[model samples]
Target: MRIAFIADPLPSFKIHKDSTYAMMVEAAKRGHDLYFML
Candidate 1:
Protein backbone atom coordinates (compact mmCIF):
# COMPACT_ATOMS: atom_id res chain seq x y z
CA MET A 1 0.00 0.00 0.00
CA ARG A 2 1.00 3.59 -0.51
CA ILE A 3 0.83 5.93 2.48
CA ALA A 4 1.40 9.64 2.34
CA PHE A 5 1.86 11.61 5.55
CA ILE A 6 1.28 15.34 5.51
CA ALA A 7 3.03 16.38 8.67
CA ASP A 8 5.53 18.66 10.31
CA PRO A 9 9.18 18.59 9.25
CA LEU A 10 10.68 15.13 9.61
CA PRO A 11 13.62 16.16 11.72
CA SER A 12 11.36 17.80 14.27
CA PHE A 13 9.67 14.54 15.23
CA LYS A 14 10.62 12.96 18.52
CA ILE A 15 10.61 9.17 18.18
CA HIS A 16 9.53 8.63 21.75
CA LYS A 17 6.50 10.91 21.60
CA ASP A 18 5.47 11.53 18.03
CA SER A 19 2.40 9.59 16.97
CA THR A 20 3.02 10.24 13.29
CA TYR A 21 6.48 8.82 13.55
CA ALA A 22 5.09 5.75 15.29
CA MET A 23 2.56 5.25 12.53
CA MET A 24 5.26 5.62 9.91
CA VAL A 25 7.35 3.00 11.63
CA GLU A 26 4.44 0.58 11.65
CA ALA A 27 3.76 1.24 7.98
CA ALA A 28 7.38 0.61 7.14
CA LYS A 29 7.30 -2.67 9.03
CA ARG A 30 4.33 -3.68 6.92
CA GLY A 31 6.24 -2.81 3.74
CA HIS A 32 4.16 0.14 2.67
CA ASP A 33 5.53 2.88 0.46
CA LEU A 34 5.69 6.10 2.45
CA TYR A 35 5.85 9.71 1.32
CA PHE A 36 6.27 12.62 3.70
CA MET A 37 4.99 16.07 2.83
CA LEU A 38 5.56 19.24 4.74
Candidate 2:
Protein backbone atom coordinates (compact mmCIF):
# COMPACT_ATOMS: atom_id res chain seq x y z
CA MET A 1 0.00 0.00 0.00
CA ARG A 2 0.90 3.62 -0.44
CA ILE A 3 0.21 6.74 1.57
CA ALA A 4 0.63 10.44 0.97
CA PHE A 5 0.91 13.18 3.55
CA ILE A 6 0.31 16.78 2.58
CA ALA A 7 1.04 19.12 5.46
CA ASP A 8 0.71 22.84 5.86
CA PRO A 9 3.85 24.74 5.00
CA LEU A 10 4.54 26.72 8.16
CA PRO A 11 3.20 24.83 11.15
CA SER A 12 2.21 21.30 10.18
CA PHE A 13 5.59 19.97 9.31
CA LYS A 14 7.89 20.35 12.28
CA ILE A 15 10.53 18.06 10.69
CA HIS A 16 12.04 15.36 12.94
CA LYS A 17 9.54 15.30 15.79
CA ASP A 18 6.31 15.85 13.92
CA SER A 19 3.52 13.28 13.71
CA THR A 20 3.66 13.39 9.92
CA TYR A 21 7.25 12.28 10.05
CA ALA A 22 6.35 9.56 12.50
CA MET A 23 3.60 8.24 10.30
CA MET A 24 5.88 8.24 7.27
CA VAL A 25 8.52 6.31 9.17
CA GLU A 26 6.01 3.80 10.42
CA ALA A 27 4.62 3.28 6.97
CA ALA A 28 8.07 2.79 5.51
CA LYS A 29 8.92 0.33 8.24
CA ARG A 30 5.87 -1.68 7.35
CA GLY A 31 6.90 -1.73 3.67
CA HIS A 32 4.58 0.96 2.48
CA ASP A 33 5.35 3.89 0.18
CA LEU A 34 4.94 7.41 1.50
CA TYR A 35 4.99 10.79 -0.17
CA PHE A 36 5.17 14.09 1.64
CA MET A 37 4.52 17.64 0.55
CA LEU A 38 5.07 20.57 2.85
By lDDT, the best candidate is 1
Cα-based TM-score, every candidate? 0.92, 0.63
lDDT of 1 by residue, 1-38 (tens): 99999999988888899999999999999999999999
lDDT, candidate 2, 1-38, per-residue tens: 97888887636567777887778778999999877676
| Model 1 stretches with alpha carbons more than 4 Å out | none
Which lDDT values do the candidates have, in the order given?
Answer: 0.96, 0.78
Provide the lDDT at 38 for model 1: 92
Evaluate residue 12 in candidate 2 and report its C-alpha lDDT on the 0 to 100 scale.
50
Q: Could you tell me how far off, in angstroms, the CA of residue 1 lies in candidate 1 after the best superposition?
A: 0.5
User: Clashes in model 1: which pairs?
Assistant: none
| Best-matching candidate per TM-score | 1
